[model samples]
Target: MKNILTLSLVTLSLTACVNRDNQYDYIETPQPNQVADLQDDDTDGVINARDLCVATPDESEINNEGCGIIITSSNERHLHILFSNDSADIQPIFSSQIRQMVEFLELYPETSIEIQGYASKVGNEEYNLALSKRRAEAVDRRIESMGIAADRVTVVGYGETHLEYDGDDEMSHARNRKVTASVVGYQGDIKKEWTIFSRLPK
Candidate 1:
């Protein structure tokens, strides 16, 4: 009985010591979830943060973080004018469209348009080259006559090189002979603006 009591006392003391020394601790968390901050570049209510020019810029514009840039937009660089089998005359029907574009450019004095001309694959390479150049120059003169500044218009020719359409048929050849009125540095209607807290570049 004395041995039994000694064993019980020893077990109780061991149990008490184990329970006293038991340990526990809490773990810390990392950074929390957050949203992107928006800022106003243009005074327009639409934040520039959501602007297409900021998120995805066309060839004409580049997004340097929050600060935006306007470069030459590729879409406005060419206006094709079809020739009469081998002529460089600016089509009468296309005149009105050219006039409207010139007027828009006039409104934005800082903007400019580049005119490119192409010819069909009918003539010899050298002839086609000269013809295309003439076509582009013709369009440039016509636009200049409309009172647009000479400096704002650039004329160039790309012989039957980059055809809009390709085939052995006349229809395809017709497509090849054309001029382009490419407007550069002109921003469309400012439908929205973005206000973004841009991080400074390292």
Candidate 2:
């Protein structure tokens, strides 16, 4: 009788797992649970689960670590300043041009510049080298005096080397004797991500 009762209980348990029509028919299947979505809410190319900084601004420059990075965008400024022969001194007339460089640095405070000074081949190579550096410094001083920080300026001189015009004409020599610099500015509108509590209706 005990074995007969145990067998009846096992049959009932097995019948519960199968369809009502247990005559070699298909078994019943439970409804599947829905899966959650993992998204890049900040849109910095990193998923929210792995993103440490969901408040990334602009999302322009970002690392795999999911944080904001400084972006450097290249811009070039050409100043028309013709220097005198055998002179490293910048004239007062070119103040406006130098001011423009200062403004460029002002627009992008995080950026620093290497002012390249060039010299004509008219003088001794050694003297011209020093003169070339001085020319770079000449612009550096002017820029610094115009409210730019001195630490942001790097002066480099190339004496009779990499001349804009290799010819010996006055215009060619004047073109060679000058300073050049490139600018890299931070770009795009900085937009902060909406936090969980800080988010509001659109």
Candidate 3:
């Protein structure tokens, strides 16, 4: 009877040990869901562990990993300033247009501009090219004087290559000899004004 009791006790002890070991093995094993949590389902250059914005669109500009599209706002203005025949000087009647440009530049500090000068078909090719260049430079200087950075402005001479009016009339020539200021490359929201000729009397 004593031997039988001892045998029964030993059997019980071994069974309990086996059950405890099995419990520990179950706890240490990783599940399928846990493994998937560490994987990146969307390949947006961001891992699943730290990605705030999952499933981002491909080829979109993002400022940070997993972040949404980065947008840049800009306003483009084409301002025409007509010049007198054979001269690069800005007319005094266009002072209001210059003031408007100054106001715009002040409102949008990140804006940059390109001043393109054009001349009528009244002079030789070389003379027209130089005159156009001088007109553009004159406008560039005027803008610079209004506290805009010099580096932000680009001056170009289109000469008679891009004439607004091709006819041999006084009004056509007046329209051809002009400078065009284009504001571009700005970031964020912008308030654009009407073009110079848009407000002028016909």
Report the poorest 10 consecutive residues by lDDT, candidate 3. 188-197
TM-score, one value per model: 0.53, 0.57, 0.56
The sequence of per-residue lDDT tens digits that candidate 2 reaches over residues 1-202 is 9999999999988887777676556568989774643698887788887788887876245667788665445666655455788887788898888788778778778788888888888979999888888888888888888898888878888888888898878888888888787766665444344555565769
* RMSD of each predicted structure: 14.3, 10.9, 12.7
**Which regions of candidate 1 fall more than 4 Å away from where they truly are?**
1-78, 184-202
lDDT of each: 0.70, 0.77, 0.79
TM-score of 2: 0.57
Give Cα distance to truth, residue 59, candidate 2, Å.
Answer: 17
Q: Per-residue lDDT tens digits of candidate 1, residues 5-97?
A: 999999887676454457433357788764644675553333565654444332222344433444333234335457777888776888877
Better of 1 and 2 by lDDT: 2
Q: What residue pairs are clashing in model 3?
A: none
Candidate of highest lDDT: 3
In candidate 3, how many Å is residue 58 off? 32
Ten residues in a row with the worst lDDT in model 1? 57-66
Best by TM-score: 2
| Model 2 accuracy (lDDT, Cα) | 0.77
